[model samples]
Target: MMPLRNPKHAPAAAAHLSRSAGVRHQGTKRSLSAQRSPAAQRAAPLNLEIEQLREKGNAAFKAGSYSIALQHYQEAQGKALTCRPVDDDLQARILSNCAAAQLHLGQPQAALQSCKRALQAVPNHTRALGRAVTCHLRMGGFSAAQGFIDALRAQPLTQAEANTCQQSKDALQALVQQALARAAKAATAEEGVQALAALEACLEDSHAPCMPSLLLTKADLLLLLDRHQDATRMVLAASEAAGWPQERLERYSKWVHAHMLYSQGQLDKAATAVSEMAEAAADDECRPAPALLPSRSAFAMLQQAEPQAFRDLAQSLTMLHQAKEEGNNAWRRQDKAAALNFYTHALEGITAPPPVFAAVVFASRAAVHRADGRLLDALADSLRSLALCPLYMRGVLRLGQLLTDMGRHELAAQELGALQKEQAAAARAHAVNATCIDLWRDVDAALKKAKEGQRQRRAIDHFEVLGVPRTLCTDDEVKKAYRQLVLKFHPDKALGRCRFSSAIHTTCRPSLAQSQLEERVRAQAHRVFSMISDASTALATRSSRITLEAQLNVAQYRTASQQQPYSPGRYSGAYQPRSSTARASRQNAYSKTYSNDYYDSDYYAYERFWAS
Candidate 1:
């Protein structure tokens, strides 16, 4: 009964149920539409932000602030990623910006990675494709860049982007043509340098175009220009870029390297370089040995001669300088004994044969004599020193002073006068001189002293100076005397080298004592030493001894012609009268004057004794 009653209302109930279902469906639809509205609103703001970021990046790029542009683009990229899904085109743009910045910054590897990522995001993206092409080219990936360029051309791109790709290819072609044309011109005209420059120049979007042939050519050109290291670098770089075996490439580069080393006059080093390359090559290499170093029997003569011809004199100088330096260092330390000792030893070791340096040391020793009141010794040293180097300014000045001190004032005046003339000539030539006035004063003072002095000191004859028999001494006897003197006074032995006796050591320590004698005695001893040196020099040579004996005989004569000017040796001057009349009238007075000089009179007596 209940079921029958519900049947009548079934239609209405079914209609009510259908209406309820429709209401629920409409609510669901409204809820879904509400969710969509918020997302759309969020999308607008996010897209605005992305656009703003992109615009900022573009502005920075336009301002030449590529690094700033890269930062902005990166921020945009990050933000895009923060969204539900990233925009491929936007990511691509960001990546392109990043690559462009990195490329300009000379970070080709970083730029290449960025471009790769960009191309991955939007394979057909025109700007991304162009950046990848440029990056690949920069990193020297010629084939890969060409592939990318082909892909980019195949893609649908804007007119401006298409123009960029087309221009890059066209410019690359132009660069190659230009380089090749320049190379041809250089080769034909022997302009190797220009050809090298052309070959080395890179196109804006092209890999290094220096092939093996070009590198070899440039290396030859560099060798011609005397750029050995540069040529080596070029050759090595070519070998590496070619990805060829070292042995295969070493032949050309090695020869070039060896030639360059040889051309630079490094023959031994060139040989060493060849030997090294040859050793590295071993049995695996077949290249002929480098034509640089020759170690043959014939070249051995050159090696042998090199020391005698080139380095012998230099080596001798080195030794001489080293010895002199050692002596000077000791002298500066106030070790007078050690200094003099070293100076004398240094003189003995000199191999250059001339006593030029001996003169200087003698002059130095003369200072010690003056300081010790050994005036005669100082005078003697002065004369020898002057004889050795007349032009030595210190020696000249000092000798003049000594001559004045020793009562040889006229001779001092004459010596100083010659120096004055030279100094005047130098001044006339506009040479600067701080010592001019002082020198003039010195000369005037000496001249005044000479004018005041009554008589000059006596000069020594050679035989008494040598302590040998005057008229006839065999060479052996002379040698024996010389050996004895050298043994006693060799500078290396401090005791023997001192000019004065041990009695001076009692007055002052030997290290500080040059002499204990009075000024007159010291001056006499100094003259004796000079005469001894002259005797030794004369006796050392048979021919020189003959010449000396002749001079000595001529000196003994008192003829009027003997009044004529007598030239002294290199380092000393002779005592001369002040005027012509004085010189002529001195004939009778010569023997008397030189009797006091101690040599001529002693020699005259000795000559008579020997004649008997």
Candidate 2:
């Protein structure tokens, strides 16, 4: 017979069972001891209870009740350890569960540490490895996260588990590659800022490859942010990093060197570096996409000589437009919203455009507004286009002219004035011939006539007080003539000087009694001056020569009435040799000249000439 087995190792075989069967053998030592401790007896039952709790915890965790499940698992872990020594595998499993709970609770740092502990206990624990990778990555630890991913991939897991791990690892690999690429190519200030953000994220995952790309990116960003020295140091470090191709390293080195030169205002060196980089990039099979060229060109342009720099910028803008068009063909498909966005971007790169294009843009926006029933907004944009380029005369005249036809005189006047000023400025700047000015003057005269006709229909000839017709009077003449009449009609005149007492009493009655006659006279004078001002302003702004002539006739008549000689042609000399002082004094008075037109025999006879 084999040596007697230890009682602890025996399977259901007890010495008492054999003795009770009456088959006791002499000289055979009993292996089974009858002195089993109470602690020993409780151990198996305690283990069974702990296992039950563990199962319940797992169920709860799967059901998404992480808090409840954590409590149950913790209790189970305590009981399991108390009953019998817990093995490494069991400890790792417990810790993994806890880490999962922590992760679910958004405590990434806590989850990271807990998962790390679990990995320490059982390095091959697949769940712990996966969770650790996730935690690290979440905390921006790409390298360390990648390490965990590699370990997970190497494990002999079930098909589903293997697939999950592989997928996750692949995604992380892509992210790492992108991050590394960004870091390596960061050659400008903006790139450096981006690299910094990427690096900060990468720090969480320590196991990630410290790619040369990251360093390059940092250097580039620093250079862009004007940290040339820092960028230079980082670039050198990156250049020394292993695994990068010689061509790539050399290219990045050139770019960094050029950036350093450029930062020091070394345009020539920068240009040389840029040329070399461009050649290398162009010849290389791994050139960056053309979409990136515009921005690079823009940067390069900044290092160019002044005038050339502007030209380069303009070229870059063109390139940008080309790239944008290539990237977004849908913009050409009559998609209004998309087209609007595209045009808006393009517009930012330029100051002004030819009138035709400006009109189109304005018209497009106006159409949208009109369709939305925002007539005022639509009108405003259309008018703005006119203001920008009044050469779009048809559009300007139609919109405002129609508004005026619809009795919106105020809006029409505003639009007309804006168009006229814009056109005038453009003509002046572009060295338009004198004939154009004459033409503009003619148009201005026409618009004035229209405005005067409108004013006349309003039942007031404010400009008539100065003994002139509504036409041909300069601003000076209107003001001067008004002052002279005010003196003649003033109620505060000496009793002997009050020639038209009955007229004053009738005109300046209850509303403006004799005591307030001065105020009324001033008010009437202002009204007359305002009319003349409007006429002058309109004459200076009309776009139609035919209309302007009509306006001049009205002005000429008004001018004739306001002067001493009362001759239509007298005021012609007033503006012939214009002087600043004369202009100022004329503007200060009610009328600076008078015409005989309003003093026709019939009007004077009606006033009943009385000697003072």
Best by TM-score: 1
Candidate 1 lDDT by residue in tens digits, 21-104: 122223223442342334443453457887898899889877878778888888888888777645555566678778766655
Q: How many Å off is the CA of 599 in candidate 2?
A: 10
Candidate 2: stretches off by over 4 Å: 1-53, 74-88, 103-108, 137-142, 149-612
* Model 1 worst lDDT window (10 residues): 1-10
TM-score of each: 0.29, 0.26
| Count of backbone collisions in candidate 2 | 62
Error of 1 at 98 (Å): 2.0
Task: Report residue 404 deviation for candidate 1 (angstroms).
Answer: 28
Residues 1-612, candidate 2: write the lDDT tens digits. 011111211111223222322333341333312222344433344357767888888898778887887788788767656645345556676777777766565445566676788777667665566566555544445556546655644233466645654565566557656765665555444554676688657533432223434444445455555565776666555444322355755655565565455333334444556555544543353232232222222123223223443344234434433433532454446465665555444334333222234444554555444544444335444554444334655456545543443234555566667767876787869956676666556456545644654564422223332344444555566556556645643334422121111110111111112223333334433433444445344433212212333344444455455454655675575534455675557434413233333344433332222110
